[model samples]
Target: MSDVMDYNSRLSDPASRKFETFSYLPAMDAASIKRQVEYLVKKGWNPAIEHIEPEYLMDSYWYMWKLPMFGETDVDRVLAEAKACHKANPNNHVRLVGYDNFKQSQGAAMVVYRGKTV
Candidate 1:
């Protein structure tokens, strides 16, 4: 169980199209998103650094389009906070990386803000 505790190793355990950033929106439909992530892990919301990435659940939508979540249960501090939020938004246009299906790396995302391209 050592692919960083195996949360599907961050993607691609036969997942044709799974995604993170829940609070519920856009509907990628993982069986109603695994019952809303098992009701946010039974309302405990584990956090070695807090924030389970949902963008805003419903009204203030952000990354609900999918592939923008974040995690770091601490390791290199989530790549130094996704490289300092992608160097404070370097002309954002769809950038979020946390490989596992890509191979092995985990935590942090949100390299999008202005150069716009949802």
Candidate 2:
């Protein structure tokens, strides 16, 4: 039996939200948004056009950014780039961004044993 338990932060509450389209708003511009898209692409993900919830999420984005598991990447650098994009334009067009986290695969069996932690 293994004592260490792995907790994945990826799993979070799923909820649907309502938002307005901030696309044309003067908050974020096209060039800056492109940078955000490029950053996501570099991280092996595509930039999704969604609204921020802001309540249960940081910056109201559900699954806003996905990072690689093993490969070494510059976290701060990428985040800074994204931040620049969001800041370059701040539009308050309400749009709904859905968020749902679940286990994609049942990898193995769970063995429950009556034991005490040492």
Candidate 3:
């Protein structure tokens, strides 16, 4: 048997460490991001945007971007809001979250933008 160990350079670097579930994967492009928003809407989950400075990512709560889009179904609108939040907070890490009303909890969450590296 060959003894080979897999080493990920990002794993050793704090700045490159994963934050959320999708963080482990490559960064998502515009079309991919839009698809995730579509999935959230299709699932009937309320979409919300949240952001925080990279240093404060470990904190439990993040600043909400406006308010949760309670009954929002338009994928464009959701993407627009997320874009706006990222534009406003260019240095902060922005994420999209899906709140499940039936389960009274968050059903999905993913980081859409990574903060600028210092």
Candidate 4:
């Protein structure tokens, strides 16, 4: 048996336009996204929005702003930030990221929020 672990990031067909944690799974809905954020908050993780502009779609690096929603209990507030980021960069690929300071790493939920069409 071949021992190979698929840990490196993956990309689906450009036509599919689906960028999710699991290549085959659909992106999480609003409710699921909220639950994830709450879970991370309860675990003492700080939330932030990151993105790669459409012009930089080929670029793997994501730009995370300095503003992070630390100690935020309201999911709406966090969602608002994500929405605002999407609104500003409507053509970009935005995502929600939670950072766990205690572990010095990111949380499990890395939600991708495809920008709105304005």
Candidate 5:
């Protein structure tokens, strides 16, 4: 399957759907996400948040703000931003992305939101 289709492989007929937004993996609760973020931080990776609308799912890029969480050792800040983004865009896709100093792109990512949570 293509990278886009990999977002939601369980769909029986994805082509028939109007629009869909999903994370690469199952959604992670706030605590679980915080733990991962903390781990990355300890490994010297900076945290950032991104989101994408379902209609724009064809766009592989995740929209990240210019200012990432830098020089911040607190996981609460990262958790807050992740929750805020997800709350603001409940129907959209949101993720916590981490970047290392040497990487031009996200080195690690976790899905904080995947549309409606069941």
Candidate 6:
């Protein structure tokens, strides 16, 4: 149908590009980011930080800031680490990931900081 074609074209437009899971939504604020961290803590998921240059956004692997914070339930600490990563890699896209140890996989991931676009 023409309507469906139009919608698909809009979604594929470069100006409307999306990154990670939360990229489809509006940019999140500090409070909202903290809330997400809180949820990860409450869910007992280990938090980790990763970053990559905007050009490598489509890459499957991102450079991990550090090891995953296993058994870390403190929301503030997780947020602090994410912020530190962003500060160190100002020109890279910083993302937060919640690793589910039991499942041995990532339970959640979202871009917290977007790098400068040329």
- The lDDT values for all models are 0.32, 0.31, 0.90, 0.70, 0.68, 0.85
- What's the TM-score of each model vs. the native? 0.22, 0.24, 0.87, 0.72, 0.70, 0.86
lDDT of 6 by residue, 34-110 (tens): 99999988999999999998766777899999999998988898889998999999998899999998999999999
Residue 9 CA displacement from its true place in model 5, Å: 1.6
lDDT of 4 by residue, 22-91 (tens): 4346667888888887887788888988887544445667888557787777888888888888778777
Question: Is 4 or 5 the stronger prediction by lDDT?
Answer: 4
A best-first ranking of the candidates according to their TM-score comes to: 3, 6, 4, 5, 2, 1
**lDDT at residue 1 of model 6 (Cα atoms):** 44
Off by over 4 Å in 3: 1-14
Could you give candidate 2's per-residue lDDT for residues 21-86 as a string of tens digits? Answer: 332234455455445434444544322222232343335343332332222244444345345434
RMSD of each: 15.0, 17.6, 3.0, 4.7, 5.9, 3.4
Candidate 6: worst 10 consecutive residues by lDDT?
A: 4-13
Q: Compute the lDDT of residue 71 as modeled in candidate 6.
A: 89
How many Å off is the CA of 106 in candidate 2?
21
Compare the candidates by lDDT and give the number of the best one. Answer: 3
Off by over 4 Å in 2: 1-26, 51-118
Error of 3 at 61 (Å): 0.9
lDDT of 5 by residue, 1-118 (tens): 6664533333344333333222434455666777888888887888888887655545668787447888667888788887888778887777777888886766787666665422
User: Which ten-residue region of model 2 has the weakest summed lDDT?
Assistant: 109-118
Q: Which is better, 1 or 4, measured by lDDT?
A: 4
Clashes of each: 0, 12, 0, 0, 0, 0
Q: Score candidate 2 by TM-score against the native.
A: 0.24
- The stretch of ten residues in a row with the least summed lDDT in candidate 1 is 47-56
Which ten-residue region of model 3 has the weakest summed lDDT?
A: 5-14
Model 5 clash tally, residue pairs: 0
Question: Higher lDDT: candidate 3 or 5?
Answer: 3
